[model samples]
Each structure stands twice: as structure tokens, then as C-alpha cells.
Target: MRYVLGIDGGGSKTVCILMNDARQVIGRSEAGSSNYQSIGIAATLKSIQSAICSAVTSTVKIEAICLGLAGVGRAADIENVKVLVQELQNSQLLPIIWDLQPSNIVICNDALIALVGGVGHDVGIVAAVGTGSIIFGRNHQGKTKRVGGWGYILGDEGSAYKIAIAGLQAALKSYDGREISTSLVENFKQHLSLASIEDLIEVIYRQGWKVKEIAALAPIVDLAAASGDEVANKIIDNAAEELIKATSTVINAIFSQNSGLEVITTGSVWRGSSKIHERFTASIINEFPHAKVIFPRFEPAYGAGLLALQRLTR
Candidate 1:
């Protein structure tokens, strides 16, 4: 039976799934993120290989492989992944496509697949706020572009990472007696299991935590906001505003032919019970006036695999 492999390589984790010729999932595997920018090409390739190996488990020919990866937007990164796939093929690690670039190997930004999950039927937008945030859009003609996904330091403004960091800052402001807010002092102590914020000093100074770990606190921020914390509410509002901005930017950029558009929200943060999603959707509808925001029907990786199928029909 012919098989296809699809991978959603995010900043925090890699999710790999193998589909049969009939598009039934036969194998699934999970590994660390294959983001070359964060994990280096060698490491990324290795992680991908490990995940693929686990997915295969048994020897089976692969008809194609689609990798929706973070930090793989550059042509050079795509070429590198192609070469790595070639190497795996020669060694019989897994079945590889004979030709590059959509020939058994298709590489695109992770956001592209996210868009596919929602806007498959018509032109729409996909905004994801997981560990990081990115908003992607595609028109009916398949013309797609990125709005904001600059990463946590700069953009990624609506991402969980952004929210969590902002929450920490607000907590610090409270500690310094600069802002009036919920008992960040009490909550943070419970959240981090520390005697006090002073304990955080040592942790921050020497034993640093991974950014994902910090981003994990985003839900807590949402809870705080829901519980009536002003600082947390502001952070959520800012993130929601940023997300709205990303969607608008893409809709305006590509939908010049028709400002009327469909928008689908994705990712953990958007799916949560934050009033932010409600506010963001309302803002989008108000501004665009004709935009129809909907929920995504499938996961992004499914879209990536379908894109692989798209190449074959051509």
C-alpha cells in the first residue's frame, strides 16, 4: 500500500503522522521540534528522522512526504531538508520521493498547513496562538502570504508565549509596588511552588527555564483575567488586538479583489475560553464588516498531507 508522511514541526514539538493510500492514519509519532532556526539543521534533521522512524516501525514504501515546518521558509532550508531526505532514502531509512520540490518532498511554512485546515473550501484566514503566534491567509486562487510570525522577541504578539511573558512582567510590576492587581504575589508563589518572588530571583539568574515552560503559564493568565485581574486582562486584550491586527493585515493584503473574507481561528489560545477570542472576532467583523470568522474543521497536519496530494494531481 502506498503511504504518505506528514509532519507538523512547531517550535515546541513535532507531530508526525503516516497516512495510507486511502488517507487513513496508520502510524503516529511525536518528537521535539524540528525548527532549524531553534534546533540547528543537524538537530532538526535528526529529530525528524527519529520521528519518522518511529512512525514507520515496519518497512513500507513512502509515496510522498510533506513537512510543514517552522523556520523552513527559506529556500536554503527547504533544499537542506530535501538533501536530508535524499540521504535517508539512499540509506533505506524510509521511502523517499525520487524528485525534489513537491515530488515526494513538499516543504512549506507550518502556517501554510494551518491555513489549509480551515480555508480549504474558500479563501479565509488562520490565526494560531500556540507557543508562538502567526496569522496566515490564502485567497481562492491559492495566493498566500504571512502577516505576523516574527517570533516571541519581536512579533508573535498574540502567542501564548507573549501572554505568559507579559503576565510575568505584570507580576513583577506588582512586586515593585508599581501596579494594583490580583495577588500575583500569592498566585505566582502557588504557581511556581516557591517561597516567594525572591525564589524566582535564583531561578532566573542561574537555572533558567525553557521559553515553552514560561509560555505554559498563558492559561493561568487567562484564568486570572477571567477572575477579574486588571493586569492580566490588559495582557489578554493586547494579545487579542495583535491577533486581530494580523488577520486584518492579511485580509487587506490579499483580498484587494474582494475585501469580504472568511476567517477561521486555530491554536490552543484561540480555542480557550478567553473573552479575547470573542473581542478579536468582533473587532474583525466590525472592521472588515464582511469577514465571516469560523472554526477550523481539521488539524494543520491534515492540511499539509492534503497539500502533498495536491502536488500529485498536478
Candidate 2:
């Protein structure tokens, strides 16, 4: 019996699942963040191998594998990752060498699998907010468009990273007396273990700032927003608005109908807070009055496995 393995290589973590030819899941595993661009290629490959091995260990030796990974936009990078995985599989001496795409790999940008998770058919959009964010969709004519994903430095609007940045800006503005904000001074000090903005500047200039490390404060922002911190509320509201704006851009590009189009959203950000989801949904409906927002019925790995099955059946 042929067995297929699927992976969703996300920035926060990696999810791997093994399935039989009949499409029954046999094993599963989780690994560290898999964004090759962010974590470096070596770490990403290690995490990918660990996840795949854990999920394929007990039963169903993998005959094929499909991976939807981050930082796979460039052809050179894709080939490098394929070699890395193949080399690992060989070093352990586990299985016969096989064509990487069919036996061990199918590289894809993270957005595509999220889109697959949203709609089984590749004819709709998925806008997601996580540690970072991006919007991806394909139309009926096999045309695809994407916006964002340049990372926290240049893009990633509406992401946890963005939220954290906005919160920081608001806090600075409050300190400067330029805006009236519920004092996040204490929260920032506590969160970053710093007593002064000088400390923040040191980290940003002398010590090299890690935006994602600050982004870890996003949950705190969410809590503050929920507790009625006006500035915090505004930051999150703006994030939600931008996320919807991304959805609208894709829908407008592909679906030019008066009744709107199929739009689905799924991610850790939407999963955590119903209030945020409600606000985001309200923003979406304002633009696409007839657009339907469906929660992902399956994890992205399941969708990748289904895609493999689709290939097999054809």
C-alpha cells in the first residue's frame, strides 16, 4: 500500500501527518518553526526532517510526500531544501533513494497550503495572520495573486508582529505627550525588562532589535484590548481592518462579481479571539456583502494530503 506524508511548515511550528493510500491518517508529529528565511536553512531542514520522521516512524513507510513550506518562492532555495532533506534521509540510511517530489518532497510557499486548507479547489482566497501574514488566492482560470509576506521589517501588516509594532509606536507617542493612551509604559517595561526608552534604543541600535521577540507581547496586547485599553483596542482594530483589506484586494482582483466571492480565513490570530474574528468579519462583509467566510474545515496538512490523493487519482 502506498503511503503519503504531508506537512505544513509554518513559522510558529511545523505539522506533519502520514496517510495511507486510502487516505486514513497513520501518524503525526510537530516540530519547530520552519520558515527557512527566518530561522535559517539549516534549522528549517532539521525541523522538517524531525517532523517527517516522527510522523512516519511507526507505520506506513512513506511512498510519497508533499510539503507546503515557507520561503519556497525561489527555485534555487527549493532545490537546496530538497537536497537537504534527501541528504538527511540518506545519512540515517532509512529508505531507498527516490525522486524527492514523489518520495520525499513537494516544496510550496506556505500561502498555497493555507489556501488549499480554505478551499479544496484552488479558486478562492485565504488571508491569514500569524507571527507574520500574507494573502494568497487562485481564480477559476488558474491565475493567482498574493500580497504581503515581506516579513515584519517591510510588510506583515495585520500580523502579531504588526500589532506589537503599533503598540510600541502608541506607547512611544503616549510618552511623548503626542497622544492620550492608557499607560502601556509599565507593561512595556515589564514585558521587555527595561526601565527606560534608552534601554529600548540600546536594543534597537546597539544590540540589534529582534522584532519577533517583541511580537511575543501580542497576547498581552490582546488582553489589554479586551480589558478596555483604548490604545490597545485601536491597535488591534487597525490590524483587523488591514487583514480585511488584504482579503478585499484579492477578491477584487479575481472575483469581479457584484455578489462578491468565496473568502475564508484561518490562523492562530483568528483562532484565539472571537472578538477579533467578529470585528474582522464585520469589516469583510462591508466590502463583500455576499462573501462567505468559512473556517478551515481541516488543517493545512490534511489539505496537502488530499492534494496528493488528487494527483494519485488523476
Question: Quick one: best lDDT, which candidate?
Answer: 1
| Runs in model 1 lying further than 4 Å from the true structure | 1-3, 20-26, 54-61, 95-104, 121-123, 256-260
lDDT of 2 by residue, 1-314 (tens): 67777788877899987777787787778999988877888898788778877876653355566778877888897887777667665756333234334434567777877777667655678887887888888887878989887888889998888887787778778888897866566688787799784577776667776776777767767777888888988888888878888878888887765744566677667764427888878877776787777787667887677666555555
All candidates' lDDT scores?
0.77, 0.75
Question: Which candidate has the highest TM-score of all?
Answer: 1
User: Alpha-carbon error at 66 in model 1, in Å?
Assistant: 1.6
What lDDT does candidate 1 reach at residue 1? 59
TM-score of 2: 0.85
Show pairs that collide, candidate 2: none
TM, every model: 0.87, 0.85
Cα TM-score of candidate 1: 0.87
